[model samples]
Target chain A: MDVKEDLYHALLMEYASGCLDEGQSLIIAAHMALSPAARKTVAQYESVGGAILDDCCGKVAMTKDALARVLDKIDCGDSPSPCVQKSKSTMAYMNAPNCLQTYVESATWTDGKGGYQTISVRTSCHRSKARIYKIDPDTVFRVNTRSPHQLTLVLEGSFHDGRAVYRRGDLIVTNGDAVLHSDAEQGCICAVAQPSVFSVKRFVQQIFIRY
Target chain B: MYITATAVKSLAPRAPHSVNKPMESGRAQPKTANTNVNGAHHKSLLLRVASKKDREAFAELFEYFAPRIKSFLMKGGSAPDLADELAQETMIAVWQKAESFNPAKANASTWIFTIARNKRIDHLRRVRPEIDPADPLLVEDDAISAPERMGQQQETEAMAEAIKGLPAEQADLLYKSFFEDKTHADIAKETKLPLGTVKSRIRIALEKLRADQKVKELWT
Candidate 1:
């Protein structure tokens, strides 16, 4: 591999291992957005890591209680009932630590429709935070955070955005604001770590609180 | 790519009758097939089984994965009983979240690894004073080196063999990079080499690892 490719791979290795600093991570993410070859190489490395992990646990057997618990949960049928309709206008909030005045408030909320839901954890002032979001089976959620750093970790289901398939547990961290299209088969569940919040009003207040 | 002379002797001898059966003969080629989608597929299947409350699948998956998780922990310097307990805890997470399995975003091992990795990290953070001190480098040496430990399964054993073939210096670098998570500069300082040379050697080692068919044998 050439110097650029090598650097890209090195960045990718660090990213995969969660060792990259914020600025370095952003650079790699931007490059990945523009370069298919780099993305593929990253995928290959991830594949290698995944494969090794599999071998380490070869034919992993779930514990005896593992299945029993699932069965029990299924028997309970724990999903929120249709009768308890979620209000469309209600927005929930989870405040951050008092010390984190400069950071955006982080919250996790589930909607009645389960279609439009988000788990956001960000600094109100600084542009660095982690958020996870999910859209129901047929709906889509749009984000327009014009920040210099963004990181996403998929928690469940899948979505297609640009060049890659965002599946369950896939970490897709990027920088800047971009259009996201996710009205696919499985919907989308993602954890987003970014420098900014989705709303400007919140951003202004965040700054005020910080100062 | 240099295999120690002794390592060549450790290969399991082939059966004479294996020559007649292509399937059996091919099986001797090393166990890389299951590492890709197969690993993920099995995980998805287990998740489905959990969602559907298929007791058999759940039991089988738990039986298989729990022990491996334990083994992984044990190798990482965790006491055997504690490793087993953590493995059980990981399985509990799997059971509780079985209904949420989504194969699109992550392969199975990645998902499981994320959970296990998170749990392990959390456990270490909770228990280790060094983590709170914020000096990761000082504590890195204490972390269990994944490559050094022999796994419970055949495929992992094969991978161990492949890793053994790498040059000692290259292997050490890879170990630090993967397990200790040391950067190129840190590795350079440790090895008394220039940063550029360390980077070059690491690049070359990874390339060689990626290209070797024999290296592929253990990943399944």
Candidate 2:
């Protein structure tokens, strides 16, 4: 497999194994929403999970009343609330994939150094900080990596890095000491997940760059 | 997609005595037909729960999957009591979400497996973002024709067979990844194998499954 396909396959394997954190999962979900191929691959991986589960021979008996309790709940009309309903509003919400819409709705954007906007997303993994960046049209954004690992997924519009252009649903993975410089031809929105410590150094760099 | 009369007869909610027989018979027997037949039976039961609120059918499904789900959770290191509670929650979700189970897309085991997986995630207090299949922006698989779409059931059966055909070590790795929720690095650490070896083994297993005639015909 080529590098991109290999990376996505690895990510999907982690996803199917339930090893991915929330932010990384959101990236995969969003990509699947846009690409049928990713969804098909994820489905195949999940079928493998199902087959393994089905093949498990060990049977741990439940507590004596387990069935009775569950049946009682069903009779009592107890069910968790259905998946979050899609709300109506906002250009960004409209453009963002359904999986990312909830986060986009609650995100509070603040001004960044280079006329861009960013919001820190709440993710379950303590090791990583997830953020969404909105870049203005015709803007150039340069970021130096401090994180050992990072993932950036384009959600809307397109950005041209020195090597290639990333459009919606495309993912860019940067590892240790890489520099990311992109120019947005149109207003661009992207989600990023990286080590939490990277944010502090980036903040410091922003201050120095501003001065 | 062809449901023989015997399959339906085996699945229909029978008398209490007969319904209890399968529970007493122990685990499902390993056979190529067992997974597909059991899947069809469970699908019918789930659909009954959906259409008629059939408690008997639900009971049969509960008897079959709850113990397995409990075992699945325990393998992931959850305490027995916690696993029991989550298993109960998963069954309840199964009842509530029965209306959403589309036989065209997934069989009973695959559907319930997802519900259990999500329950485990929620128990860990982690969010798992899922793509809504109904989302307007979601791209549909137009490459598949109508006749090919009808092959999903056979594909699932073929998948189970392919998994069974895998080498013991490769199958063990898959069990670790799915049942134990271990990452490649975790498996590597535990097995004392290189991470690349673990990953490649998994990839090889998946590629083998994908190579099944039904699976390849349907998806690729």
Candidate 3:
């Protein structure tokens, strides 16, 4: 809460612009849930960026099939589980108390009720239109009928989202699914994060589709 | 190809409207694309640059980053022409020094950003030619202040209403601070006033920006 003003502003702009890395993004996202004021600041900055992007109507570059192109360029094939990387870094910083361990351990969680569980973290890492959301078990964590789906992947944990329980070695399909969800009790924790403005874009798309 | 001078350059290909057409396959695919070696790891882009012989990748990197560098330099007070020239130079440096790029040290954007910031500092020193880091003028005062001040004014319409309500000197400082990114020294230099006086005006300007009734009303 006592973050430097410069750091706050820098983080605000970075978070709003979807410029932060995954770790930073996750930190900010967690903060958004804890601090309404930070969330408001983020929303406010997003408004600023939205206005800028709007004014930039034709100024910002729009890659045709950019999502696809960037996706193809990435070599996700047989890549090591992201948790290994996370734990490795966490291990490097293991000097800290048990909190870091809990943080990584929380990457896989049980609902504590045995009813539902989260499986893995799914992220679409487009710089401006990035997102990281958790995939919960017993629930599809469905993108509403009018959501723009980006690249989805399992970052950590495992659970059955109405399909197979994708463990560490599983590669979830990036696209070609209209709807899906994890239904296993061994809850999954995947992220469905996206850029803040994509919701707005999706809203507009919804209106367009309805019209 | 004329390069199809469109209003905006599209970096990724978009799916065409017609069904018969298969989208051109090789540009880059977001989905099913090569899994990124670095997933937004701050230095992912720079790490990619570390390996030699990725010239096409380097150019793509340059194309996206150069304009941003130009904008950053210009915002920090370099002349437009100078910023543009330096931007090109920075890209060249990126190419020549790509081998030495270290992802462990800094990410691509940060590395490029540092290069630009350094270039601007170097340019400032050359243009001013006065060695005086001790000058209060060079101090960066844009350090994080209360977030409340940054709100509402983010919108130009709101800013316009707020600025209309500010005293002229205060308004001038606001413009100089945000628009020209002028330091206390530069503002003093421009207005022929003492650095202390410039700082006071900037504070007063911030007050008005902070207290804009329109912003207050919107927030409430």
TM-scores of all models? 0.43, 0.81, 0.27
Off by over 4 Å in 3: A1-211, B1-42, B76-81, B99-105, B124-181, B188-220
The alpha-carbon lDDT assigned to residue B9 of candidate 3 equals 19
Minimal lDDT window, size 10, model 3 chain A: A51-60
Candidate 1 chain A weakest lDDT stretch, 10 residues: A94-103
Q: What pairs collide in candidate 2? A: none
Q: What's the DockQ for every one of the candidates?
A: 0.06, 0.37, 0.01
The alpha-carbon lDDT assigned to residue A106 of candidate 1 equals 32
Q: Compared with the true structure, what per-residue lDDT tens digits does model 1 show for residues B89-168?
A: 67666666677664443455555554554456446642100011121211122322243222212223234345445665
* Each prediction's whole-model lDDT (CA): 0.46, 0.70, 0.39
What DockQ does predicted model 2 obtain?
Answer: 0.37
iRMSD (1 decimal) for each model: 12.7, 4.4, 17.0
Accuracy of chain B in candidate 2 (TM-score)? 0.81
How much is the lDDT of residue B209 in candidate 2? 73
Q: What's the TM-score of chain A alone for every prediction? A: 0.40, 0.73, 0.31
Q: What are the RMSD figures for all models against the true structure?
A: 16.2, 9.4, 24.1
Q: Is candidate 1 or candidate 2 better by lDDT?
A: 2
- In Å, residue A40's CA in model 1 sits off its true spot by 3.9
Q: State the lDDT of candidate 3 residue by residue for B1-220, as single tens digits.
A: 1122121114212212111222233212222112122224323444465665454565566555565555545545567666666666665556556677543322354445444543554454321111122322222223334443333233333433454455545544443443244544455676666554555554544445546665454333
Would candidate 1 be rated incorrect, acceptable, medium or high by CAPRI criteria?
Answer: incorrect
